[model samples]
Target chain A: MISFYPGPSQVYEKVPKWVKVAFDEGILGINHRSGRFEKMLAQVYQLLQEKLGVPADYTISFVSSATECWEIIAQSFVQESSFHLYNGAFGEKWCRTTKPLVAETAGYKFDFQEGLDLDQVIIPEDVEVICLTHNETSNGTQIRPSLVTALRENYPDTLIAVDATSSMAGVALNFDQADLWFASVQKCFGLPAGMGILICSPAAAARAEELQRRDHYNSWLKLRDNAIKLQTHLTPNVLDIYLLQQSMLERKPIDKVEEKVFTRYQQWSEFIPQLSGVDWLVKQEALRSRTVLALEGDPATLSALHQKAEVAGFTLGKGYGSWKKSTLRIANFPAMKRDAIDGLQTALLT
Target chain B: MISFYPGPSQVYEKVPKWVKVAFDEGILGINHRSGRFEKMLAQVYQLLQEKLGVPADYTISFVSSATECWEIIAQSFVQESSFHLYNGAFGEKWCRTTKPLVAETAGYKFDFQEGLDLDQVIIPEDVEVICLTHNETSNGTQIRPSLVTALRENYPDTLIAVDATSSMAGVALNFDQADLWFASVQKCFGLPAGMGILICSPAAAARAEELQRRDHYNSWLKLRDNAIKLQTHLTPNVLDIYLLQQSMLERKPIDKVEEKVFTRYQQWSEFIPQLSGVDWLVKQEALRSRTVLALEGDPATLSALHQKAEVAGFTLGKGYGSWKKSTLRIANFPAMKRDAIDGLQTALLT
Candidate 1:
C-alpha cells in the first residue's frame, strides 16, 4: 500500500533490513545493562543530536510515546502552575493531561484557522513552565521558533517545553532556545510508533532534580538518571530504537533534510491552488506545518476521496477530532516516495 | 555472545524471518483504523486468550510497556485506597510511582526471600485495590496462585491486580481470578521490548468508567472503549505489536509451555545444590520462579563469576538493586536452548 497516514508514516526502505539484522544478532535480547545495549543507545542518542542539531550538553531519553512525555513533564515539573498554549488537538490533549499537576492550569486556546497570538497569551508571573506544540499535526499548523525565543527572553524564569512530534525531522528546531523538546518516533521520523525521544536541557534536568515528586517510570528525573548510563528507566522499545538509529544514520544533516522536506511542502502548498474544491486549512504560510498539510474540503467529498484513494492502493490520513470531516491531513515526510505522491495525485484526479 | 538475561530474554529463531515478512507485507504501516489491522489485533487477542486461558468476557489492550500499565492502572482503578505488596525492586518501584495515589495508597513491605504471608497482611476496609507481582524478577520469587486466590475470596470487593511482567508465559496463571493482569512482550514472550498486554475483567472496567477524573490517554475506560474496535486509545507500538503477534502465534499451548519451563526450573533447582557456595535465594521451592532463578553467593564471588561468564561468551543477569552483587539471576524461559544452559553449567564449573 502507498501509505500517507500522518504520524506512523512510511519508513526508509533500509530500516527493515537493519531490524532483521538487529534480531538475528540477538541485539533484541541483550540486557539493557550490558555494554552492548548501552553502546547502541548512546549511538542512537548521538545520531539524534547530529541529525537534529541538539546541543552537546542536552540529553535524550527514550520513553513509551509523546503522550507519556506530557505526563513526565507534568509529573516532574510544574509543581505550581504551567502556561499551556493550544492551537489543535494534540496541544489541547496535552493541556487536558496536566489536570492532575495543579489545582488549575492557565491555558490560551486559539482557533484552528488562526496562528498563536503571542500577545494574547498571558503567562502568570509564577508559571514556571510553558507548554506548546511546535507543530500541530491535527490541523497542520506550525509554531515559529521566534515566538519561543521571545517567550524565553520575556519570561526568563519559565521553562519552555515543545512537543515536536510531527515536525522535528521535517523542520529545523532551535533546540538551544527550548528547555525541553519531545517527539514520537512516528510522524516526521517516518517510523512505526512506540518510542518517544525527550531532549532535555541542563536547566530542565536541574529542575527535575529539585522536584521530590519526580518518581514515576517516565518521570524526567528518573529518565535523566537512567540516561546518564545510556539506558532507559524501563525496558524500552529496543527494535524501534535500532530502526530510529538507522534512519538517523541515513538522514542528511539537519539543514539538508530540512531543506528537502520544506521544498516538498512548498510543492504541495503550491499545488493546493490548482486542485479544485480543496483549500489550505492553515491560513498563514508561516503558521503551516511543513510535514502535515491540512486541506479544507466538503466532508462527503473528503470521505469519498479517502475511499477512492484506498481502493486505488493509496492511504490518506483522516481529519482528526473536530476536523474529522472538514479537513484532511497529508504527510510530506522525507521517507514518502515521489511515486506515492504521484499515486495520491492520480487517485485524487480520478 | 551467549545471552541469558532474564525478562528481555532470547527471541525465537523464527522471529527475524517473521519480522521481515511483516515489514515486506507492509503490515507495519497498516492503517490502524482499517479492518485489516483490527482483524490482526483481534486475532492476536483471541490467540492470547486461547493460549493463556483468559476468560471470554475479559478485554485486552496493547500498551507501550508494562511500566506504562502501572500508570494506567493507578490512574484508572485506584481512587480511594490501594495496598501494594512489595518483595523486590520492581514492586518497590511500583509503590513509589503510585505514591501520588497517596490519598489512597498503603504500602506493605515484605522480605524478598520469603513468600507473601496472606494472614499477616492487613487489608484496610477502605482499600479498594490490592496490587502484587506474580514473579519478582529481581529476586526470582514467585507468588503462589493459591495464596492469591485465597486473598481474592477473602476480599471479594477489592480489585486484584497482578504484574506478571516476568512470569506470564512461563507459568500457568488463573486469569479468571484476577481483576487485571499485565505483562511486557520482552519477558516470557521472547520478543523485543516496547509493547505490554493488559487483560482486565468487567469489574475493573466498571470501576475505570466511574472514575470522575479519568484523563483520556492513560484512562482504562478510553482504552477499553477503543479496544472494542481493536484500536488503541493512543498511537501504539505498531511494529512491536506485530512482532508480539508473531511470537504469540509461535507460542505453544500454555499448559505445554509451562511444563517445559517448569522442567527446566526443576533441573536448575537440582543442579544449583551441587555447586559450591551457591544456594537458592528464595529458600522455599514453592516460592521460586520457574523463569528467573536467583542464586545466592558471596558478593565478590558472584561479581567474579559474572565477569568470567561474560568472557566465556555468556551474558548473565545481575540480581537487581540490593541483590546485584550477591546474587545471579538465571533465566529459564522457552527461548533458551539446552546448549546454552549446558554452557552456563560448564562456565560455572570452570
Candidate 2:
C-alpha cells in the first residue's frame, strides 16, 4: 500500500532488516544506561549530527516526540516573555503550550499565500524568546531562512527557537543561527514517530541552568546533565532511535537531499495549475513549502478526489482546522520516490 | 550478547518478526485516521483491556511515552492541589514535576525495606489529585494495591493517578479502582521504549473538562477527543504501537503471567539472602516488588559481581539516585528466562 500522509512517513527498506537484527541479537532489552546502550545512543547521535551538519558544540537530546520538545522549551526558557510568530494551526498549538509560564506572547498572522514578513512583524526588546515554525505544515507555507538571519541581526539577545518538525532533514538549516532546534523522527527523517531530536546551543543550556523554577521531566538542565553521560531524562524510544540512526546513514548530504526534494515540490507546483478546478493553497511561489504541498480545489471535487485516491492506495493529509473542507496536503519528503509521485500525477490526471 | 538490563527491558523474541512484517507490509506509514490504523488500534486497546481487566467505562489513550502522560496529568487534574507519595527516585521525580501547582506535598520517606504505609498516609480533603508510583524502580519497592483501595474509600472526590512504569504488565493491577493509570511500553510489555498506554476514568475526563487553563498538547480534553478517532494529540510512535499490539495479543492472561513472574521473583528473593554481604534493599518481603528485586551489596563485591555478570552475558540494573553506589536491581519479568537468572546467580556467587 502506498502511504502519502505527511508523517508517520515511509521508512527505509533496510530499517526493518536492522530491527530484526536488533531483536534477534538480543539488544532490545538492555538497560538504556548500560555501556552497550550508551554506545548505541552515541552512535545514533553522532550519525544525526553528521547528517544534519550540526556544529560540534551542539548537543542532541532525544526525547519522546516533538510535542514534548515544546514543553521542554517552555519549561526551560520563557521565564519572562516569548514572542511567537503564528501563521497556521501548528504555530497556534505551539503558542498554546506556553500558557503555563508567566510570559507574554506576540502573534503575527501572515496570509497563507505569503512568506513571513520580518519587516511587518514587531518584536519587543524585552521579549526573552522568539518561537517560529520553520515550515508551517498545516498550510504548507515555508519560512525563508532569511527570516532567521534577519532575527539574529535585529534581536541579538532574544533566544530563537525553531520548530523544524516538518522541514529539518529535508532542508539545510543553519544551527548556529538558532538557540534551539527540534523535530520528530517521522517526517523528513523517514522513521516512525516515536523520538524527537533536540539540538541546544550552549547559550540555551546556560539559560536553562539559570531558571529558578523546578522542572523535573521537561527540564533542559536535567536533560543536559543526562546528555553529559549520553543518557536521556527518562527511558528513551530505543527502537525508533535505532531506526533513525539507520535512516540518517542512508541519507545523502544535505545539499543533495534538499535539491531532489525541492525539485519534486517544484514539479508539483508547476503541474497543479494545469488541472481543472485545482490551485495551490499557499498561492505565492516563494512561500510554498518544499516538503508539504497544500492544494485548494472545489470542496466536492477535493472530496471525490480524496476518496478516489484512498481507494487507489494513496492516503493524503486533510487540511487542518479552518481549511478542512477545501484543501489537501501532499507530502514530498525525501522518502517519497519519484515513481510514487509520478503515479500520483497519473492518478490525478485520470 | 545477553542483555539483562531491566527495561527498556528485553523484547519478546517474536517482536522483531512482527515489526518486520509491519514494515514489509507497508502498514507502518498509514494515517492513524485510516480504517486500517483504527482497526489496529482498536484491537490493541481491546486486547489490553481484556488482559489488564480494565473497567468498561475507562478509555485508553496511546501517547508517545509515560513521561508525556505525567505532563497530561499535571495539566489536566492538578488545578487546585496535588499530593505526591514519594518512596524513591521515580516517585521523587513525579513530585518535582508537580511543584508548579502543588498546594502541599506529603513526603513520607519509607525505608527501602518497607512499602508505602497505607494507614499513616493521609489524603487531605482539599487535595484535588493523589499521585503515586506503583513500582519504585529505583529502590525495588512496590506499593500494595491496598493503598489505592484505601484512598478510593476515604477520598472519593480526589482523582487518583498512578505511574506503573515498571510494574503494570509484570504484576496484577486493578485498573478499575484507579481514576487514571499509565505505564511505558518498555518495562513489562516486552517491547522497546516509545509508547505509553493511559487508561482514564470518565471522572478524570470531567475534571480535565473543568480545567480553566490546559496546555493544548498535554491537555487531556484534546487527547481524549482525538482518542475517540483513534488518533493522538501528536504524531504517535506507530512502530512501537504495532509492536505493543503484537505483545498484547501474545501476552498470557494476567493470572498466569503474574504467577510465572512471581515464582521467578520468589526464587530470587529466597536466594538473594544466601549471598555473602548481600541483602534485600526493601526491609520487608511484603514490600519488595516482584518485578524489580532491589539488592544492597558491598560496593566492591557488587562491582566485581557486575563485571563477572557482564562477562557471563548478563547485565543488571544499577540502583538509581541515592542507592547508586551500593544497589543492584534484578528484573523478573516474564520475558526473562530462568536460565539467565540462574546464570546471574552463579556469576554473583563466583
Candidate 3:
C-alpha cells in the first residue's frame, strides 16, 4: 500500500537499493567504537551538516528517538525550570513530560489556528530554557523558521530547544534560531524509525556544561563529550546511521527539497477546499504546516473515508490525541513521490 | 569479513533475506502506533517469550540499547541504592555510570582469573537492588544461572538485575532468578545494532509502581504503561523490531541453542589450547563465558595476530579496558557458522 500517514509516511524509492548495498558491503557487523565506525560516523555527520545547512560550529548527536531529546534537555539544559510555548498536543506532551524531571515547568498555550503571539506571552525570569515545537505534527500547525529567529532576537539569553520531528528534512530551518533541534529519521529521512538527529549550537553545549547534570546516561553534556569524538554515548543504531549516510548522499539539498515540499503543499492547500468532504483543521494558512496537513470531518465520515482510502491502496494517518476520530493527517515529506500524491488525490475523489 | 568482535558481531545469514521481505512488505512505512504495528509487536513479544522461555508474568520492553536499560533501572527500580558485583569492565562501567544517578552505590570486584565468591560478598540492608552481569563481554567472564538463582534465595526481598547482552539468546537463562534482564540484539540475536530487549518480572513492575518514578521518557513505569498496550513509549527502531521478530521465528528454542553454544564453547576450548601462541585469559574454566573467549598475549603479539586475522579475512575483537593490548576476544554466539569457526582456528594454526 502507498502510505499517506504522517511520520513513517513513505519510504524513499532508493532506500531498498541502499539496504542491499549495506548488506553487500558488510556494514552491519562492524564495532561501534572501531576506526571504521568513527570514519563512517564522521562522513554521515558532515553530510548532514552540508545538506541541511547547519552552521560549522553546530555539532550533532545520534540518539534513539526525537522523544529522548526531551529527557536530555530537561535533565541537563535547565538549571531551575523550563518555559513551554505550545499550540497543540505534541508540544503540550513535551512540556508535561519534562515537569517531573526538572524542578518546574510552566506552559502557556495559544490557539492552534491563530498562531503564536510572542508579544503577549510572558516568560518567567527563572526559566532557563524555552521549549517550542517547530512543527506540531498532532495538529498540523507550524512555527516558521523566521518566527523562531525573531523569538531568538526577543529572548537573547534563554536557550531555545525546538522539536522539528516532522519538518526538519522537508523544510529549510535556520539553525541560528534555536540552541537545540531534533528530529526522528522515520519522517523526512524516509528510512525507518530507530534513530534521531540532534543538532545543537555551541550555546546549548555550554549551557549543558554549566548545569553539570551529568547524572543520567542521556545527559546532554555526557552525550556531547562522546559526540565531539565522533562516537555515541552508547551503542547506537549502526544500520540506521549507515542508511542515513546513504540517504543524505542521494538527497537533494534542503532548499531544493523545501521548494518541492512547499509546491506540493500549495497543491494540497488549493485542492482541499474543492473536495466534497472534510475541511482544513488549521484555519489560518500561515499557521498550517508545510510537511503535514490535518483534515477535519465527523467521525463517521472520516471512518468511511479511511475505509475507501484503504480499499484503494492508500493508508491515511488517523488523528492523534484529542483529534483521534475527527481528523486525518497527510505527510508532505520530501521523499513522497509526485505519483503517490496524485494517486492519493485520485483515490480520494472516488 | 566474518566478524568475531563480541558485538555488533556476525549478523544472521537470513537477516538480509528477511530485510528484503520487510522492504517488499512496506513494513518500514507503517506508523508505530497503528493496529498493524501493535499486532506485529505482540507477535514479536510472544515469540521471544516462547523461544527464550521467559516466565509468563515477565513482560518485555523494546528499547534502543542495553545501555539504556541501565538508566531505566536506576531511575525506577532502586529505592535507595544498588550493590554491584563485577569482575570486569562492562559491569564496573554500569556501576560507575549509575553512581551519579543513584544516591549511593558500592561495588565488589572479584578476580577475572577466578570467579565470584558469593560467600565473601556482603550487601548493605539499604541496597535495594543487586546488579550483576550475566556475561561480562569485556573480559570474557560469566555468572551462571545457578549462582544467580542462589543469590536470589539469599536476598529474596531485593531486586536482581542482570546485563546479559552477549549471552541472552545463546543460553537458556532462568528468568525467575532475576527481576530484570536485558540484552542487545546485535549479539546473540544476530541482528544489526539498533535495538535492545528488556524483560521485567511482575515484582519489578510492582516496585516501579511503588516508586512511581515516571519522570522521563525512558522511565520504567512509563515504558510499561505503553508496553502493556502493545505499544512503545516512543517511535522505536521499527526495522530492528521487524528483524527481531523474524529472527525469533527462525531461531531454535533457548535450551537447544544453549546446548549448541556449550558445544561450540567446548570446541573453542579444545582448539585454542592446541594453538601455537596465545593462552587463555581466564584460568578457571568455570568462570569463562560460553559465548565469548578471551586469550592472553603480549601487546605486540596480539597486534600482529589482529593483522594476520585481517589478512586471513577474519576479524578478531580487540581487548577492552585494562586488557586493551594484552588480549583478544572470540565470539561463540549461536549465529556464527561452524565453517567460520573452524576457518579461524586454521588461520590461527598458520
Candidate 4:
C-alpha cells in the first residue's frame, strides 16, 4: 500500500535495508551511554548539518515528539507570557497548551486563506515568547519564511519558537530566523513516528540557561547538556535515530530535496483541482503547504473518495479538525515514490 | 555478539520478522488518529493486561520512557513534596528530578547491600507522593514485593509511585501494592528502546484529577483523558507499540515468566560468585534483582575482564554511577537465550 497521509505517512523504501543494517550491527543492543551510540548521534547531527545547511552554532537534539517541544518552551523560556500567531487547528492547540503554564498566553488567529499577517500581530512588551507554526499540518497552510524573518527582526529580544513539524526537512529553513525550531521525523524525514528534532540557536540555549528549570528530565537545560555530549537525557529511540541517519545519508542538501518536493507537490497542486467534486482547500495559491496538501468536497463526496482510495491500496490522509469530513489531505514527502504519486493521480482520474 | 547490557538491551529474536510483518501490513503508514491506530493501541493494552495480570480497575498507558513518569508524578500529584526510599542511583535520580518542580523533596538512601527497609522508612503526613524503585539496575538490588505491600499499608493516604524500570515484565508485581508503576520496555519486556509503560491504580487517577495540571503535554490528567479513548495525547511511537504487541503475544503470564527469571537468576547467582575475582554485589541473596545481576571486582580486574569479554563476543553490561569502575552489570532479561548465557559462563570459566 502507498500512503499519502501526512506525518507518519510513509517510511523510505530503503528503511527496511537500513533497519537490517542496524540489526546486523547490533545497534539495538548497545547501551545508550556507550561510545558507539554516542558516535552514531554525532554522525546524525553532522548529517543534519550537512544535508540541511543548519548553522554551525545551532544545536540539534532528539525529543519524543514535536508536541513535547511545546511543553519545553513554556516551561523553560517563558517566564511570564507568550504570543501566538496562528490560523489552523495545530496553532490553536499550541496556544491552548501554553495558556495554562504561564501568566498570560495571548493568541492572534489569522484568516486561513490569508496565512500569517505579521503587520497585524501585536505582542505585549513582556511576552517573552512568540510562537509560530511554520507549517500548519491541520489546514494545509504555512507561514512564509520571509514573514518569519521579518518577525524575528521585529521582536529581536523575544524568543522565536517555530513549530516546523511538517516543513523541517522538506524546506530550506533559515535556522537563524528562529531561536527554537522543532519537527517530528515522521513528516518529511520519511521515518516512522517516534522521534522529534529540536534545533536551537545559541540564543535559545542561553535563554534556557537563564530559566534553569531542571525539574523535568526533558527540560532544555538537561537536554542541551546531554546533547552537547552527543547523548539524550533519557534512553532514546536508538533504532529510529539510526534509521534517520541512514535515510539522510542517501539524500543531498535541503535545496535539492525541497526542489524534488516542489516538483511532486506541483503534480498534486495542478492535478487535485481537476478531479470530480474536489477543489483545493486553500484558495490562495501562496498559502498552501508544500508537504501537506488539502482538497475540499462535501462530506459524502469526501468520504466516498476516502473509501475508494483505501480499496485501491492508496491510503489518503483524513482531513483534520474543523475540516475533518469536508476535506482530504495528501502528503507530498521526499520519500514518497514517483510511481506511487503517479498511481494516486491515476486512480483519482479513473 | 550476545549482549547483557541492562537497557536498550537485546530485543526479542523475533523482532526483525515482526518488523517485516509491520512493514508488510502498512503499520508504519497509518494516521495516528485513525481507527486502525486506536484498535492497535487497545489490543496492546489488552495484551499487557492478560500477560501481566494487571488489575481490571488499573489503567495502563504508554509514555516516552520511565523517566518521563517522574515529571508526570511531580507535576500532577505533588502539591507539597515527595519522599523517596531508594538504594541505588536511579532512585536518587528520581528524587533529584522531582526536587526542582515541587515545594520540598526528601530522599532516604538505603544500603545497596540490603535493599529497601520499609520498616524504617517514615514519611511525613504532608508528603503527597512516595517514590520507590522496585528494582535498582545500577547495583542490581530490588525491593521485595512484601515490603512494598507493607509500605502501602503504612501510608494509606499518600500516593505511592514505583519505578520498576528493569523489573515490571520480569517480576510478578502486585498492582494493588502501588498507585503508579512505570517501566521502560528495553529491560524486561525485551523490546528495543523508545517506549515505556505506566500502570496507574484508580487512586492514582483520582489524584491526577484533583491536581489537574494541564500545563504540559504529559500531565496525567491529559494522558488519562486520551487513554480512555484508546489513544495517546500525542503522536506516539506506533511502530514500537506494534512491535511490543507482537513480542508479548509469544509470552505467558507474568507469574510464569517470573518463575523462569528466578530460575535463570539462580543460575547466575550460583555461578558468578565462583568466578575468579568476582563476587555478588548484593550480599543478601534476597536483595539481588532477578533481571540485573551485578558482579564485584577490583577496578583493574573488572576492566581487564570487560576487555576480555569483548574479544570473547560477549557484551556485558557496564557498571554505572558511583560503582562505575568496580562492578559489571548483566541484564538477565526474558528475551536472553539460554545458550547465550551458557556461552558467557563458559567464556568466564575458561
Candidate 5:
C-alpha cells in the first residue's frame, strides 16, 4: 500500500536498494569517530547544502528527531525568554516544552482554523529567540517564507528558529530567513524516522557559544564544533544517515522534487474544495500548507473516507491533535508517487 | 570480518531477516499512537522483563541513545547535588554532562587503570542521586552487581542510576538495586545504534514526580505517564525498536545468554593473561568486564597484533580515549560466535 501518513509516512522506492548497499558496506559497524564516518557526514552536509540552498557558513548536525531540536534550542539559545508564534498543537507544544527551561516563555496563539496572520505578529524586546513552525502538520497551516524574512529583518538581534518538520525537503525554503532550521528525515526525506537534520547559521552558533551551557550532551556549541569536523557528539544512527545520503543521491534535484510535490498538492487542493462536505482547514489559501493538507468533514464521515481510501490500497494521514477525528490529513511528501495521488483522488471521488 | 569494537560493534546474524520482516510488515509506516504500535511496545516491554528481570514496578521508556538518557535523568531526577562515581571516560562524561544542569554536581574519579570500588565511596548529605556506570565501555570495566545492592542499602534515600550501556543484555542486572537503568541497543542487544532503553523504578518515578521538572519533552514524569499506555513522549526510532524486538525473539533466555557470554569471556581471559607482553587494564579480576575486554601493551605491538588479526579476517577494537594506540580491546557480546572468538584466540596466540 502507498502510505500518505503525515510524517513517518512512506519510504522511497529506492530505499530497499540503499539498505542493501548499507548492509554490504558494513555501514552499521563503522565507528562514529572513524575517518569513513567523518567523510560520509561531510558528504551528507554538502548534499544538504547544495540541495536545500543552505548557506555555506551554516553548520549541519544530526539529532535524533525534531522534538529533540526543541529541547536543544531551549538549552542553547533561550537564555531569557522566547516568543512562540503558534497556530496549532505543535506550535503550542514548542512553547510549553520551553517554558520550564527558560526564565519566561511567551506564546501568541493564532486561531487554528484561520491560521497565522504575519502582519499581526509582535516580537517582544526581551525575547531572545522567536520560535515559529514553518508548517503546522496538525492544522495544515504554514507561515509564509516572507514572514520569516520579515521576522529576521525586524529582530536582527534575536534568534529565529523554525521547525520545518513537515516541509523542509518537499518545499523550497529560503534558508537565509532563519538562524536555525530543523527537520526529521521521516517526513520529506523519504527515509526512516530515527534521525533529524539541524541546520544552524553561524550567528546561531555564536548565540549558543555565548550561552555556554556545557552540561548537556547535545550542547549546541559542541554540536557546532564537532559538526565542523564532520562528526556528532554522540553515536548517531549511522544506517539512517547512510540511507538518507543514498536517497538524496537517487532522487532528482531538490527544485524538481519540490515542483513535483507542489504540482500534485495543487491538483489535490483544487479538487478537494469541489468535493462534497469537504473543505481545507485553513480559510486563507496562501496559509494552507502544500505538504500536509488537512481536510474538514464530520468525524464519522472522515473516518469512512479514510477507510474507503485504505480499502483502495491508499493510506491517508489521520487528523492530529484536537482534529483527530473531524479531519483527514494527507501528506504530499516528495516520496509520494503520482499514481498514489491519482488513486487517492479516485478513491475519494468515487 | 569478526568485529570486536565494543558498542555499535556488531549486528546479530539474524538482523537481516528481522529487518526484512519489519519492512514487509510495514512497521515503519504505522502511527506511533496506533494500537498496533502500542501492542508492539507492550510486547517489547514484556520480552525485556521476562529476559532481563526488570521489576514489575519498573517503567520502560525508549529514548534516542544513552547520551539522551543522561540529559533526561539530570533534568528529571536531580533536585540538588548529585554524587557521580566515575572510573573512565564514559563515567566522567556522565558527571561532566550533569554538572551544569543540577544545583551542584560532585564527581569522584577513580583511576582508569584501577576501576571503581563502591565500598570506599562516600555520599554527601546534599546528594540526592548517586550515579554509577555498571559497565564502563571506554575502559572495559564493570561495577559488580553486589556493589549496586550494597550502595542501595547504604543510601536508602539517594536514588541510584546505572549506565548499563555495554553490559545489560550480556549480564544479569538486579533491577531492585538501582532506581534507574539505561542502555543503548547497539551493545549487548546486538542491534544497530539509534535507540536506548530506559528502565525506571516506581520509586524513581515518584522522585521525578516530586521534582516535577516538566519543561522538557523527555521529562521523566511525561515519559512515565506516556509509558503506562506503552507510548513514548516523542516520535521514537520505530525500525530500531522493531529490530530489538526481533533480536530478542531470536535469542535464548537472558540467563542462558549470560552464561554463554561469561563462559566464553572466562576462557578468553584465561588465555589473555598468558599472552606475551599483554596484561589486563584493571588489576582486579572482578572489575574486568565480561563483554568488553581491554588489554594493555606497547602501542606498536598492539598495532601489529591488530593488523595480524585483520589479515586473518578479524577486526579488533582499538583502545579508546588515552589508550587509543597502546591497547587492543575485544568485545564478547552475545552476538559474537564461539568460532569467531576461537579464531581471534588462534590468530593472536600463533
Candidate 6:
C-alpha cells in the first residue's frame, strides 16, 4: 500500500539496491574507526552539504533522531534560557522538553491556524537561544523565512535554532536565517527512521564552545570534533548512514525536488479547499506547510476516509497528539510523486 | 571476506532473509505508534528476555548505541558520585566520560593484565553508583560473575550498572547482579550497529523514579515509562531492531551459545599458547574473554599475518586503541562458526 504517514512515510526507490550493496560489501560489520568508515562518513557529509545547501562553514552531526537533537541543543547551547515560538503540538512539545533542562524556557503560543507575529515575540535579556519550529508537522503550519530573518536581526547576540524536521529537503531553507538547523532523514531524504542530521553554523558552534558543557556523549563540541575527523563520538548506525548516502547518490537535484514538491502542494492546497467534508488546518496561505497537508474533518468521517484510502492501496497519516481522530495529515515529502498525491486526492474524494 | 572485527563483526546468517521480510511487510515506513509496531516491539522485547535471561521485573529501552547508555546512567541514576572500576581503554573512557556529567566521578584503574580485586576496592560514603564493564573488549579480559555477585552482596545500597557491550548475549550474565545492563546489538546478537538495549531492573527503576530526572527524551525514567508501552522515547532505528528480532528468532539458547563460545575459547586459548609468533594478552585463563581473542605479537609480523589472513578470504580484527599494530583481535561471537575459527587458526599457523 502507498504510505503517506508524514516522517518515516516512504523510502527512496534506491534503498533496496543500496541495502543489497551494503550487505555484499560488508558495510554493516566494518570497523567505525577504519579508513573505510572515515571515508564513507566524509563522503556522506559532503553529499549532505552539496544536496541540502548546507553552508561550507556549517558542521553536520549524524545523530539518532530529531528528539535527540533537542536535548543536545538544550544542553550545549541553552546555558540559561530559551525563548520558543509555539503554535502546534510539536512546537509545544519542544518547549516542554527543553524547559526542565534549561534554566528557563519561555514560549509565546500562537493560534494553530495563525503564523507567528514577530512583534509579539519577546526575548528576555538572559535568554541564550531562540528556538523555532520551521514546519510544525502536527498542524501543517510553517514559519516563514522572514520571521527567522527578523529574529536574527533583532536578537543578533542570541543563538537561533530551527527545528526543520519536516521541511529541510522538501523545500529550500535559507540556511543563514538560523544558527542551527536539524531534520530527521525519514521526512525528506526518504530513508528509514533511525538517523538525524544536524547542521550547526559557526555561530552556534561558538555559542556551544563558549559554554563548553561537554557533559553528554553527543555534546555539540564533541560531535563537532568528531565530525571534523569524519567520525562520530560513538559507534553510529553505519548501515543507515550508508543507506542515506545511497539515497543521495545521483538523485534529482534538491532544487528540482523542492520545485516538484511545492508545485504539488500548491495544487493540493487549492484543490483541498474546494473538496467537501475536509478543511485545511492552517487558514493563512503563507503559514501552510509544503511538506504535510493537515486536513480537519469529522472524527468518524476522517476514520472512514483513512480506512477507504487503505482499501484503495493508499495509507494516509493519522492526526498527531490531541487531534488523532479528527484530522488527516498527508505527507507531501519529496518521495511522494505528483501522481501519488493525485491518487490520494481522488481516493479522498471517493 | 570473513569478518572478525569484534563487535559489528558478522551478523546472523538469516539477517538478509529477515530484512527482506521487513521490506516485504513495509515495516520500515510503518508508524512507531501503530499497533503493528507495538506488536513488533513486544515480540522483540520477549525474544530478548527469553534469550538473555532479562528478569521479568526488568524493563528494556531501545536506544541509539551503548555510549548513550553512559549518559542516561549518569543523568538518571548517579545523583552525585560514582565509583568506576577501570581497567582497559573502554573502562577508562567510561569513567572519563562520566566524570564530566556526575557531581563527582572517581576510579581505581587496574592493570590490563589483571582483573578487579574486590577485596581491595574502596567505596566512599557518598558514592551512589558503581560502574563496571562486563567485558573489557580492548584487552580481552572479562570481569567474572563472582566479582559482580560479590559487589552486589557488599554494596547492596549502591546501584550497580554494567556495560555489557561486548559480551551480553555471548555469555550468560547474572542480570540480578546489576541494576542496569546495556549492550550494543552488533556484538553477539549478530545485527548491524546503531541500536542499544538497556535493561533496567526494579531497583534501577526505583532509583530513576526516586530521582525523577526525566528531562531528556532518553532519560532512564522516560525510557522505562515508554518501555511499559513497548516503545522507545524517540523514533529508533526500526530496521536494526527488526534485524535484531530476526536474529533472536529460533536461535541457540543463551546457555548453549555460552557453552559453545567457552568451549571454542578454551580450545583457542590452548592452541594459541603453542603458536610460534603470537601470544595471548590476558595471561590467566580464567580472566580471558570468550568473545574476543586478543593476540599480541611483533608489529610487523602481526600486520603481515593479518594481510595473509585477508588474502585467504578471512578478515581479522586489527589491534584497537594503543595496541594498533601488535595485536590481532579475533571475534568468537555466536555468528562465527567453529570451522571458521579453526580455519583462522590454520591460516595464522601458516
Candidate lDDT scores, in order, read: 0.82, 0.80, 0.88, 0.87, 0.84, 0.84
Question: lDDT of candidate 2?
Answer: 0.80
Rank order by TM-score, top first? Answer: 3, 4, 6, 5, 1, 2
Best lDDT among the predictions, by candidate number:
3
lDDT of 5 at A233: 88
CA shift at A174, candidate 4, in angstroms? 1.2
Docking quality tier of model 6: medium
| Displacement of the residue B85 alpha carbon in candidate 2, Å | 3.2
lDDT of 3 at A54: 87
lDDT of 1 by residue, A67-105 (tens): 888888887876878778888888988888887666568
Q: Can you give the DockQ of every candidate in the order shown?
A: 0.58, 0.63, 0.79, 0.77, 0.62, 0.69
| lDDT tens digits, residue span A183-268, model 3 | 99989888888989888998988887777888887777778889888888888989889989988988889999999999999999
lDDT of 2 by residue, A1-350 (tens): 66677777676667778888777766666677777778888887787778788887887898878888888888777686877887999988788777655457666677666667788887888988889899888888888888789888888888999999999999999899999999987888877677788999888877776785445466787788888898887778877777776777777888899998888877887788777887888777888889988888889888877777766767778877898888888888888877777877777777
Worst 10 residues of 4 chain A by lDDT: A16-25
lDDT of 6 at B60: 85
For candidate 5, write residues B245-347 as lDDT tens digits. Answer: 7777677777899899889887987898768888888778877899999998998778878887888877788888887877788989998877888888889
Task: Highest DockQ: give the candidate number.
Answer: 3
Candidate 1 has a TM-score of 0.93
Candidate 1 chain B: worst 10 consecutive residues by lDDT?
A: B209-218
Predicted candidate 6 versus true structure: per-residue lDDT over B1-350, tens digit per residue = 66889977877666666666676677877778778789989998888888878888888889998988998999898788988997888988899889888878999998767677887877796789899999988888888889899999999988999999999999999998889899998998888888898888898888888998977778888787777887777887888878777778877779999998888888887888677788888888788888988999998878888887887767888887898777889888988866777787788777
lDDT of candidate 5 over A86-161, digit per residue (tens): 9889989989888888888899988876666667877678788899999998989887778888888888888899
**Second chain alone, TM-score for each candidate:** 0.96, 0.95, 0.98, 0.98, 0.96, 0.97
Model 4, position A203, has a per-residue lDDT of 88
Tens-digit lDDT track of model 1 for B137-161: 9989888889789978988988999
Interface RMSD, every prediction, one decimal place: 1.9, 2.0, 1.2, 1.1, 1.6, 1.4
Instruction: State model 3's lDDT.
Output: 0.88
Give the higher-TM-score candidate: 4 or 5: 4
Q: Model 4 segments beyond 4 Å from truth?
A: none
**What range of 10 consecutive residues in model 2 chain B has the weakest lDDT sum?**
B101-110
Sort by lDDT, best first: 3, 4, 6, 5, 1, 2
Q: Which window of 10 residues has the lowest lDDT sum in candidate 5 chain B?
A: B112-121
